[model samples]
Target: MADLLDQKVQAQSLVDVVAERLEAAIISGTLEPGSRLSEQALAASLGVSRGPLREAIRRLEGRKLLERTPNIGVRVAALSLRDLKEILEVREALEGMACALAAQNMSDEDIAALEGLIEAHGEQEAVREGKGYYQESKDFDFHFRIVTGAGNQRLEQMLLGDLYYLLRVYRYKSSTKPGRAKEALVEHQNIVAAIRNRDAGAAEGAMRVHLRNARRYVEEQLVEEGEAVVDPAPRKTGRVGSLR
Candidate 1:
């Protein structure tokens, strides 16, 4: 007899899809912090029953975005400098690991994609003058390229998952400063150069420096903005941890 626990994977519902969408909504700043999610309204808008919507909200709660209040249901979690630092630190480690592996395993096609992506998106003028959304997407592509290049599926998903949460904070506070975008592009170049030379150590070093710089910058911003509490709330749960 088949064990009940080992049953085949079931199909997910529209609720599950909307849940991920809502998760991204919160992660991308579409859903503002402290905003309350209305079950009736959301269900109506999404054209779904309350059951899936509630389940979805509960899932978001477990991820730390929607906190369950005693009588009041839930509100979107607020961002803080402390939370950003912790997230970025974890991101740094995973990204550094990706760079090291990419240096050794990146194929010619992967290298081409990286180079092309940088060439198209590396223009300081575009990042400095272009739409913030474009820059954000560009940044995402670069990071994704590295993760995919690394040939480590698990690690890749983990890194990108953390960045999704970070991106929400980024969209709100102008996380990457004016000159910082160009600097980051240069930093990406440095990492790529090391990879091209097949210097895993150098690639890892460059990647770490990049992530550390990002973490430090965001940390400073959080403090300067006065959102830096004495002790910030702990993360609910990582949005996504699996790389692949």
Candidate 2:
């Protein structure tokens, strides 16, 4: 009985590991949205058996990161403009709460660490030489720190687990907008200052404003390009540890 239970546990662990690896690939844009997920090819590439690979794909489907059709197998989830805007709106509510809690609860050491993250963003070639943009990793780090600092288990899981991968997909898609990247650094600075002062209300307000501005910028860009923005499907609405 014990041996049988252990084997089952190990199998589940493999599935979880496989799911996480595939999730990271999808999030990082290595698996582009709408790309087909070939089961035999993926199983062979990852050196895993077909059983575990299929289980992992099912896990992603539960997370809404993969969609399966009767004829098409599975594909990475694609977001439309409305999808992006709705994501930002949900982020505003959740992250604003996180910023407020972080201001009140974070240790002095954590706050300093966040400031260091901002300084690193400022030193990037784009921000420094006025020729490039802040790297997405640095941008994600700043927000991840604050959310983790909030010290809420469920909140951390919701943001990091559910929304984060999708967030990365959209960020990469919209990163080409002129001038927004530089402006984002300045907004981040304001958010950091508010947290440094331990001003919960100000921290929350600043975080919301920054994200809302991002949403507005994307909407405007869509209009300019004449892309039809669809309405976001309502979904019921995270950060800790080294994301890298």
Candidate 3:
């Protein structure tokens, strides 16, 4: 009886577990934007009660990964190209700030770990195929660490909680463009070099330039495909901080 009670307390609840699985699917693009989330189907597929499934969805909704309509029920959030530009704008400032802080605050061990991560990325099959880039998630893992290393709790939560996931979906969609992967690798190296030297200004500048190039690539693709590019010019948001 004691063992049973202890196990009950120790095991993850169905809701939290389900929420995590659903969140992963969303992030991985397995559940594409605007995909309907049917409660009945999801509960049946996952072999869970509707009650727990609903709870799981509620959690995802809080994370901004799901949206519920009055009569239509829940679906994954879809971002417009305009929305993408706006998001990347926020990412430019926030991540640039993160890079700057990481240069100042990250420990020597952490910096070494980042170098090792970059080295590992260089060995990926994609890189060897002359693709020359880390997979989307692997690439994000590098940025995620830097964001966390910033040591700002609110900033960490804002980036990791919502914006990053949305960015991942878009980036995964765009990752297939020829030559982009190779270009991203070069930019990643530049950002890392600046951080290693503890040049906060250089680190932030490198990060902005990298993301700007990425945004430009997306814009060029959209234009080539005959889609309207909203505000193609990148705006200079005021400096995030005085980078030392």
| Candidate 1 RMSD computed on C-alpha atoms after optimal superposition onto the true structure | 10.1
Question: Which ranges of candidate 3 are over 4 A from the true structure?
Answer: 1-17, 44-47, 120-140, 152-154, 157-161, 218-244
Window of ten residues with lowest summed lDDT in model 3 = 1-10
In model 1, the runs with Cα more than 4 Å from the true position are 1-70, 78-80, 123-126, 130-140, 157-174, 229-244
Clashing pairs in 3: none
Best by TM-score: 3
Better of 2 and 3 by lDDT: 2
lDDT per model vs. reference: 0.65, 0.70, 0.69
Q: Which 10-residue window of candidate 2 scores lowest in summed lDDT?
A: 235-244
Residue 164, candidate 3: C-alpha displacement in angstroms:
3.4
- Clash number for every model? 4, 2, 0
> Which window of 10 residues has the lowest lDDT sum in candidate 1?
1-10
Better-scoring candidate (lDDT), 1 or 2: 2
Clashes of 2: 2
TM-score of each: 0.63, 0.66, 0.70
* Residue 8 displacement in candidate 3 (angstroms): 22
